[model samples]
Target: MSLIHALVAQGSTIMAEHQAGKRDFSQATQTILSKIPPNNSKLTYVWEQYLFHYISEGGFTYLVMADDSAGRRMPFTFLGELQRKFIASPTASSSTTSLAPHALQSTFGPVISQLMYTYNTSPPTDDLARAQSELAQVKDIMVQNVEQILSRGERIELLVDKTDTMASQATAFRRGARTVRRQMWWKNKRVLALGIIVALVIVWIIMAQFCGAALRCGSN
Candidate 1:
């Protein structure tokens, strides 16, 4: 993979460049970019025996200059991988955050090298076939994950509702228990008062009987 140049850009500004000569590569990238329109996916052209391709994501554009023998699709695949790495980088919170050349290199140099090695260094004769197979597998996995999330969404909502209902019922039960306890306490107090009143009345009657007996004896 004779990839002579690559760069990360913020609009027209070259934030980072990779090649034998950083300044020369950055200049070449800018020169190539000056001749092309943004997001020109359907269009590709050769410049000085080097094929250039670009993918614009957000405010940042990723460009690659490769040897003519390098097929058209590899650059794009390279751009995709690079853009994903750039966006997922910790220093880059968003596409708007432009990383300087050294910062970009420090963050993604190893990844860039690995991708180029895997895809550019003596790649299979049928790179397109391999890319297509990998793409199909990715598509299938995404579809399954989305379906699972959709199904689980309903269950999550139901679980939330059940949790809320249980919380409300528990509060109501606590209130009811307090009320029952208070009522029982008052009822017991009333029973104790009634028993004391009855005992006092019985004592008064016994004293009156004794007094009458003494009066009768005095009269005799």
Candidate 2:
């Protein structure tokens, strides 16, 4: 099975176990965490790992840590990391062929709505203004598309055409966001490179002038 399918399956099992008051949540959490890259610096993993340990040990310190840090930071980072990993990994296009439109709509619809609402109500900060604006626009467009489909209230075949449409939109959003980040990175690199080159040139000119003065003095 694909990684996504495996994750979905594990998630469903974990939910079931949690509802039944079983002790499998820790195992399931560990399994999921193992799949993520070790280099991931997101604090969500620390939070989840702490929660898992807390549940297993029933220790007060684990609970305290969870309450103090994990509870506040994990949910958003966890969801964001899942989204990023899902987009970055390769998937069987055929598997996505079976996904229902309403399923897609139901899954992402509320998320997009929440983002839209958040962007509109939140004041722009100096660092996040561009990101906020871009996210707002993307959410607006996604909301319109999802609403249009939901309005039709009819089942559409998970055809290539529909899949392509959704995939293209997702790809475009990811590409555009990454493009902005890459441009900023390259801009900084260019500035640093130019500064280094200029400094080297100045040093060479100063050394040449010094050598010329030394030669003239020695001859005189």
Candidate 3:
């Protein structure tokens, strides 16, 4: 599965969450959540073969863990969807000051489960499956190695001047393949259109020679 786990939290207090597999991510997720700055941000933390993507805004963080093969796009898109849904829910109106841990679990836990299931089962291969136009901004989001977040002196707020080289190369390859496919499709279309036109012209020429353009002739 692409999406393995997801959670909504206020600071280090998890309000609600969903895990899609048998693996326990509780300890790892809590550790990561504690490190997230209590401010507006979007980032991906690469650890081993998995990617932890999170969006922190309005004192709440929406996070999703996915296999790196899912790439940067899909997980962030899932977070975007999760954020939108959270904003619309009554849970958003609750006072963050008085909120208790896992308070929304009873109410919003099912929502997270459904969303996780949807995104995990349905890969975002088309525009329709995408969360929204917001996905267009995903490329601009910062991607950092997990070590960056764990290191004491390292800057956590580094600019997105570099992306994971392997992921970038893979993206480039996919784009190149798409461009070639589109060019070939158009080339074939133009060739077919030109052939049809040439065949029509040849038929007209034969008709003109046999029957004359302006002179209507009877079969003799």
Candidate 4:
């Protein structure tokens, strides 16, 4: 059971989905679907002997259940191909917000099943698969522990708070620097003005003394 199940959903709502192999994966699938973040993300979850890999983008999630031996690259590559097919399908035209549970089962379910089989039977050396695998590698999908995923929201909030505090501190620093610059500029301007006034006064006194306030020295 290398590729056991695959699902395409909008948030927690199942749009189109399919499963292969003898194992009943509904319970595990539901749990994973419900917990997947709505934001754009790529992550892998380990549950027992199986691995759940998913990509969430544009409010839609493409997820796969595979045997632990399947490795990361192939499962992600399958998801990449699945996404391309889903986008080209007519069902993709429907509004995501209005989609109900299993809304696209009749239209897109077979597509998922066919894809699951292809990846399960074929090797990953094909050109398309190789290209897709490289794309997944570039994404650097996160491998998440169950405990870590549960606590991620809290950690993100804490990080946001720290960022806000740093931004405010930076703003305050810039304002203080500007205020100091303005004060120094005014201080220098005042000193220059005072020096000019004093120089003018000294020059007037010298002229008065030398020229005799009322009459010129040369005339006397």
* TM-score top scorer: 4
Residue range 1-220, candidate 2, lDDT tens digits? 0011112111112211111122223433434333323232222223212322111111101111222232322323223333443344343122243343233333433443343234234523442544445444542211011111122323221212345679999999999999999999999999999999999999999999999999999999
Off by over 4 Å in 3: 123-140, 147-220
The global Cα lDDT (0 to 1) of model 2 is: 0.35
Q: How does each model score on lDDT?
A: 0.61, 0.35, 0.80, 0.79
Q: What does candidate 3 score on TM?
A: 0.61
lDDT for each residue of candidate 4 in 1-220, tens digit (9 for 90 to 100): 6888899988888888888977666766677777776689888987656788999999899999888898887888889889999999888978445688898999899999988888888845784568665765575587754432224232211112334679999999999999999999999999999999999999999987876845764566
Per-residue lDDT of 53 in model 2: 18
Flag clash pairs in model 3: none
The top-ranked prediction according to lDDT is 3
Q: Is candidate 3 or candidate 4 better by lDDT?
A: 3
* Candidate 2: Cα lDDT at 102: 31
* Candidate rank order under TM-score: 4, 3, 1, 2
Q: By TM-score, is 1 or 2 better?
A: 1
Candidate achieving higher lDDT, 1 or 2: 1
- Model 3: per-residue Cα lDDT over 5-58, one tens digit each: 999998889999989988776767887787777668888888768798999998
Task: Itemize residue pairs with steric clashes in candidate 2.
Answer: none
Which residue ranges in model 4 land beyond 4 Å of their true spot?
A: 127-140, 147-220
